[model samples]
Target chain A: MKYCFGVDIGGTTVKMGLFQIDGVLLEKWEIPSHTENEGAAILPDVAASIEELCEKKKIAKDQIEGVGIGVPAPVTEVGIVQNTANLGWGYKEVKKEMEELTGLKVRLGNDANVAALGEMWLGAGKGEKNIVMVTLGTGVGGGVILEGHPLVGTNGAGGEIGHICVNETETETCGCGKKGCLEQYASATGIARLAALRLEKDAKSSLLRSQEHVDAKAVFDALKAQDEIAEEIVEEFGKYLGHALANIAVVVDPAVIVIGGGVSKAGEILLDYIVKNYRANAFFANQDVQFKLAELGNDAGICGAAKLILD
Target chain B: MKYCFGVDIGGTTVKMGLFQIDGVLLEKWEIPSHTENEGAAILPDVAASIEELCEKKKIAKDQIEGVGIGVPAPVTEVGIVQNTANLGWGYKEVKKEMEELTGLKVRLGNDANVAALGEMWLGAGKGEKNIVMVTLGTGVGGGVILEGHPLVGTNGAGGEIGHICVNETETETCGCGKKGCLEQYASATGIARLAALRLEKDAKSSLLRSQEHVDAKAVFDALKAQDEIAEEIVEEFGKYLGHALANIAVVVDPAVIVIGGGVSKAGEILLDYIVKNYRANAFFANQDVQFKLAELGNDAGICGAAKLILD
Candidate 1:
């Protein structure tokens, strides 16, 4: 069976996975992402590790298809990484540099977009050609796959759902310099922010006041036990995210919306809440969109990255 | 040059356009629509028009590429128009029927979606593959083209941007049985509603109080003449439409947004207001999306419908 490599570049670590061309992931590993001096060592480090793996396995280079990579940046249509903020990259022609080093074909994709492909391929969105995925971690990450193709927009910023304005009247600004973004209300950090706001509003009857770290997990746990304040916090979060998603549905009209990332572990409870709000806000014809939790977990980025080359 | 026919099926009329395969409009005409019996006469009427045109022009059937049609309905991938409400059509095999009747191939599309294709090909979004078109007439109609292809959702309900919820607390219901839909605030009727509310709220100081019919055009005229009440009403309309569009941009990230329909006749005055609000609400990368008036006007549907056959 032909082999291929999938590389996922993050701010802290670079993840690498080995897979058969038909999509059997055989092994995976990671290495430190060297962002010093404009990330000069990042690609070189990835190249070296890949070469070492090929040598150790005695796998002929001819037997491998190519490499697929996911980066934390808006990728232009021609394979230029517009900006990998975390990797300290700026307009890097990754496809060319990587191919020249490895002497193999290379495919480039935005990390969140690649993970979305992974989920569609092997996780919650499997079997669906049109789907939207929102990774609700510290911040929200989004990727829309339309007609079995990742929507790499004009500036490779097509599926940036996190910044969709949910509330225009807000005092605080989002990390992306936007105000009242969906990310400010629907993410893991956003949930905790809501939890804090609720605690401050009703300090006398709040369950979250006792927790040292009032994180999303604590809020959900409290809600599972039927805490009033926790319930309200989760409800508000769901309303913002669900409504934003409904608005998104009006554009692509995906068959499913996959919920993933650190906060999605809230699982069915979270799904149920988001679905409730989604129904109320969605266009009449698109109100029946399926909601599913991502199944591939942490392996999504690597798997999706691999798909770039395979596709 | 080869020839093709474009047909637009609407509630009151069926517009027909003859175009060269090289993207030139050769001739055009229209016929009264007969929706008297479940739209049974619609396709037959369309067939007659094409047959008569072929005979009049002495154009052989083999010299024509195919007929492209746009109907006010959700058309499934396989060519079944799910529902043509205005035409009284329900789940009709339009493509098959038209092909059989004409003895030539046929392509089908939703009206709004076809107009979007038209705008992309030869109207406002010309030369751009990704675009979103909003037609703000008595109601709002929307279509999204991604990678130059119209996004027809699972139920053929894709690109239904009019119904995206901009406010959840609204008590009044929209025609689609929803509350706070963008359609309720962004359509020509919606603009009139806003104008009425403004007149009521500021009865003592409104110029619209003197007008017999406070339609969208009247409101824009007052705004053009620097009426304070008119300005407020327009701003409110812009906010709703702009914010909703920003939410849409988070998904498709189009290069341009084309505004069409009767309301768009307000032209640059309306375009500037919407663009201002859109820039404020859109994702940063998408904030730069160009705004333009739909150039094809009444011909967009016919022109875009023809694209279905050529594409």
Candidate 2:
């Protein structure tokens, strides 16, 4: 049986998985990311880890297909990364270096994009080729898959859904230095910001006012108890997210929208509000788009990274 | 030299073209569309014309590549058109029928999409493979081409840019049974509607008030003459179109946006207002997207239809 390695490189950890050609995971492990010295050791470390794993498993080099990597930065189709601030790398030739170090073919994709591919392959979007996956983490991330391939545009900027301007009139700036980005209203932090804004707007209180640190988890927990203020905050968050997805549907018309990330831990309850707003704003022809929760969670990165080589 | 046939079936006429495999238009002509009898005669007519041309030119079947068709309706990847209200067709197997009739390989695409492809091949987006083309005619129609292929969605609803909800708070309903659609403000008729609304909001002394019919042309002509009310209407139009495009860019990250259709007759002046608002609301990474006017006018359909076969 042929084998392949999937690697997800984040700021702190390098997650790796060995999988059968047909997608069955044989083993998975991690290594701490050595990002000092411009992340010069990161590729070397990854290559050494793969070599060590192969030696321990007694797998021949010819048995392995290649290595697929998902990086925490925008990656060009050719495997060049312009800026990986999180990984302490600047304009690195990731694919070339990795291939040279391990003498294995390498494929690279953006983390969020590969995660979406994972979902499409074996997670919530399984069996569906066209899907839009939104990750509502500390910051919102998006990955668009069309016909089983990620929609990686000319400059690797496709599926930058978090930066979509949902509210054009807002004065507040987003982390991208843009005003009224979807990330400013629909991310995990954005949800807490909504709760904060709601609390600041009115004295109506019950659960949130009692919390010292209000976050997306707290907001959902409070709403589960039928908190009126939490309800409003969720509604506003749903409007921004759902409306943005509706707009996205107009462009790509994905069969399903998979919601993941930290905020999605709120469970299926989150989809209720989001689906309601999505239907209310979606184009007539696209009103029936299915909404599903991402199932792979953290493992999505590795699985999706593996998919990169298979594709 | 191998030859191909490009047929663009419109509501009133069917424009047919004979092209060399290299994309040179050898000959072109038109035939009246018989939309009566549920448009049953349309495909048969298209086939007969192509067969007659081959016979007249003494071209054998071996010398022909295939035929590409552009229909005025949503088309699935397999070339099934769910509804063609203008052509009086419903639930038609366009590709199968055409292939049977002509005994040649057949390819079908949406008219707007093929027009965008035509522009990409030889018009404004000549060298670009990723492009979003918006046709601002009686209505706003869009075609998104990625890596030189039209993005045909699950149910053929992809690239329906006109129906995106740009203004969620709008009370007036759009033609698509939605409220606040971009088409309500960005189409040619939408521009006239904006002019009407602007004139009605205040008794502003403007050149539009004197016109019997204040259409998009009147608004642009008045703006050129430095009419204040006309400028306001154009600004509103530009805001809707430009902002909607910015949202689209975040989803697909196209290299260029090609503007076409009837309203583009206003020339470079139209690009000014649109570019201004687009820069104001676009994501930081996508602020440099190029905007160009479509170079192929009515012939875009035929050229793009021809390209469908080539692809």
Candidate 3:
């Protein structure tokens, strides 16, 4: 019957959720992220909302297990956030300060790691202890949950799968200033960029040729309508995505791989393409990796953040 | 004050070591592996060795910790060897059989994983909890030690790092029946193969043209002599190796990468090439990975097998 809070801190908003120790999320909400003054009010504001909830519900503080927060920055095992660039944060003792403010134990994890944990707990990768969840949002982000624990690395940067080089001979740089990264070909932006490149190269008699704005969605939509150009674009994207997953399989050998994000809304087709390509490139022993669509979507961050403490 | 035996089961010979609980090796030896009759004599042979050791040393049965064996096969968490193709084993209850035979506790691990653990315990990667050990022997092989423990996956095939696909366009198949695996580019055989390819393409005045057999050693010796074609061959090998390490870095984010196996005899030059390429392609945050040569050499297997019991 104990309760706990899972907080997902972002650049613009902080996603929060209340959950039972048994894995049921009872409530959820969001608070505007105050990055002003170097995010000075962010922690205090979160503490205040939690304190108010405690007072209004007449719930004893001890009845709650504590809080688990997922940060956008690299967080150490002791809960020190190195720096959340978007939050203007530069090394905060998150666990210590949060515990002092709320008078409860606090746990911390990276946002992607927490999300992968959340999925392993209640979303697409349920019942699987070894899982890898790839989020194809604006950029590629992922979490590695091995034997049910997020591999928060020596420097807390273990699951940065997006930066893995997929194309070694690239001219352009990635957002991280790397060239030929997986995020360049597998992210939403990457897919859109590929579509744009295709259209620019040779869009002969293609439906995408007429669209004013060509994007990842346009490419998938074209595929649904059986457009040849779209099929080619999707196939290339699949090649990178599939190859990336295959590489990860050798290192982690996860039981399941959950695909999520804005690009994943393309649904089964995306899942099938990635899986097919992954099988072709994966190590023989890891060829049968289970592929699943992320079910929690936006709530994954909150749910996974909470799972930090649950674990 | 307690003693234990570490056994490494190989295709042709079994390496055994005697150790103290405090990580001191007192003695070591080897025995011929009998693959006849479905390898039925393997366990009995191992047990006889341990039993004889105990009696000769006059060590009390209760004073000994147990035996830990590293098998050349996938070993489940519960110590079951699914099969050792070379050993003619098919799903042997390794732990139970060993325990019953020696009248002591027993544990099991994959040979590569055990070697990695051994290296972490007392070799090149000492004091580092997160480590990835790459073995470039006849074929590429490896073991991942995360958070100071072997990551024995659900199917005990977790550390199959060699078979990870590095070249998606590879038309030739690897020994594992896969195409363009890291093993095909980084192993001793792979390096020799690359040298042959380079020699065939253009070896106008190369020193390798003098040697009747251009092996991995010949290539490295040529590199030391500053041969042009050899340098090109090494560069291509470095490119694939560097890319593979960069890819593995994001997954494990280990503090150190230890290079071992027959090909590693090239020493600093080999380490330098892999590290140079690794840094170029690594994720920005994980660019400071420490690269070291495994110090244990041929003894890694026996030491690692013994270390498994310590864990």
* lDDT winner: 2
lDDT of 1 by residue, B70-94 (tens): 9898898878976667888887899
Question: Would you list the rank order by lDDT, best first?
Answer: 2, 1, 3
TM-score of each: 0.96, 0.99, 0.98
DockQ result, candidate 2: 0.84
Model 2 chain A lowest lDDT segment of ten: A197-206
Tell me the tens digit of each residue's lDDT in model 2 across A1-311: 99999999999999999999898999999999999998888999999999999999999999999999999888987899999878899999999999999999899999999999989988999999999999999999999999899999877888999999989788889999988899998999999998999999978866999999999999999999999999999999999999999999988999999999999999999999999999988887788899999999999999999999998
lDDT of 3 by residue, A18-98 (tens): 898898988888899999998999999999988888787677899999899998988998999878889878889999999
User: Candidate 3 i-RMS (Å)?
Assistant: 0.9
Model 1 chain B poorest ten-residue lDDT run: B198-207
Candidate 1, clashing residue pairs?
none
- How far in Å is the alpha carbon of B288 misplaced in model 3? 0.4
lDDT of 2 at A201: 95
Candidates, ranked, TM-score:
2, 3, 1
lDDT of 3 by residue, B1-311 (tens): 99888888999999999999888989999999999999999999989888888889889899888898889898888889877779999979989888888888898999999999889988999999999999999988899999888888867888798998888788889998889998888998999999888888854789999999999999999999999888988988998998899899888899999999999999899987898899889898789889999999878887778777777
Q: Name the lDDT of candidate 3.
A: 0.89
Q: Give the chain B TM-score achieved by candidate 2.
A: 0.98
Tens-digit lDDT track of model 2 for B1-311: 99998899999999999999887899999999999999999999999999999999999988888999999998988889989979989899999999999999999999989999999987999989999999999999999999999998887878999999899788889998999999999999999888888899988799999999999999999999999999999999999888999889988989999999999999999999999999988887788999999999998999899999998
